[model samples]
Target: MMIEDVKLSIRHRAQRNYERQFDERNRVQTDGIVTLGRLTIESPNKNMGSEYVPSPGRLIEHAFAHLPPDLREYTFIDVGSGKGRILLHAALHDFKQIIGVEFAAELHAISKQNIAAFSAANKHHPPISGVLGDAIDFIIPDGKCVFFFYNPFGRPVMERVLENIAASYRQEPRKIYFMFLSLKHERGNDADANRELLERQAYLRPLKSWNANRGAWIKLQFGSHKLTMYETADAGNPIKRRQRGANGAAASHLE
Candidate 1:
């Protein structure tokens, strides 16, 4: 065989091996452990087992790659943080504060353990907090923030989360950036159900969708997949009105 052909064969074999191990590790395990960064979660769906893989760590790293340098001063929050990988990485990036909210008790405990292990390994690093609570009820910090999601749940739950965010913005308007990954599904259409919920929320604008390279790697293992990033505009001053004239009398007098 030609030298190039031989090299290609080796690459193909290596790729296949990687997929086989991923499948074996993920297949039939009840705590959905999707590997994103160093974190993994037990898939909430018991039937699927906890093998539901979250976004790969590389993809998330890419998502934050374009963030302005100033975002280093903001807090980064990850909802449905399975094992706190995102939070930990955010800390390394120098985000002022990093918070991860997870609903599963077992996963939350695991996350804490992982954080401790990481902290001990990197003694000089800042701390990243992993909260044992539902993302819906967790208090959002007041400041420029980055919210990340990896299709943590169904559409209904996403709607409620968006509503909560809207309410938070209303209370204290600030800049918010949303990083959504793995948005497409096997059905091959934009996940409009959740997208619609985001569209209706005030003070949010769909900046644009950029094709993420991480999807290519995922596709190599899981057939085909795509990832998109959508950013939300900074919340501006709340709409208010000035009393320009006498209430009821002014209208009649002008007429």
Candidate 2:
């Protein structure tokens, strides 16, 4: 196997082992809350299942490590955002807007309640909103957007979302940052294909990879997961095409 493939294999194995350990715990901490900057919100709980665990806090920190230092001007959007943990954290930054899209009705309610409560406490800040809708169907706002995911769904849904984003890029190109966490080895091929497709459109660029050591103690502390950031290239200018005339010449402008 190639060197990159070998590294991915090791990473996948470590992640699986860590997930298994979390499963064995059998404890659900859904109602637990964490403070992000001045906002209080519900945090990730293992009971939500392995798929719902929020991206590791360390992973989020590392992903933003190389940011331009003017994060406040950006907007962060988290799909399948559970309990608003990621959204709340993003709000603490300089992000102009923070939005979370959650399909589960119960989870969506929880997120709204948490955001409302946080807003009441921090009256000086603008309130963040959580929409109850399928991530696949949610409408992404037009602008420089930071999209976040923590293995929210399976490959098929992911593919559809990528296609949707590609379409959006075509319409109104914007810098898009995709942050994927706890990605597995088996999904590497599909992931790379999606990345290639985005690159082919001249829409994205791989920015950084945050790999965490997965020793026994480390796994016990944060579960099994790593994070990576993919940045966006400048949006291409819209191209305008003209139709050919009857004789293959440029079409005359109609009055």
Q: Candidate 2, after superposition: displacement of residue 37 in Å?
A: 33
RMSD of each: 9.8, 10.8
- Model 1 residue runs over 4 Å out of place are 1-52, 187-192, 209-225, 234-255
lDDT of 1: 0.60
Off by over 4 Å in 2: 1-51, 183-202, 209-223, 237-255
- Top TM-score model: 1
The residue-level lDDT of candidate 1 at 195 comes to 62
Alpha-carbon RMSD, candidate 2 = 10.8
lDDT of 2 at 24: 33
lDDT of 2 by residue, 100-158 (tens): 98766667777787676666555555347898766677786887778887766555666
The Cα error of candidate 1 at residue 252, in Å, is 29
lDDT of 1 at 201: 51
Tens-digit per-residue lDDT, 1-255, candidate 1: 996576556545655554444334423111235533333434343222222345554445656776766666678888877766666667667787788888676667777876776666566655589887666677878887889876665676677677787677778777787776553443432345556655555456554534434445445443323444545554575623222365543221110
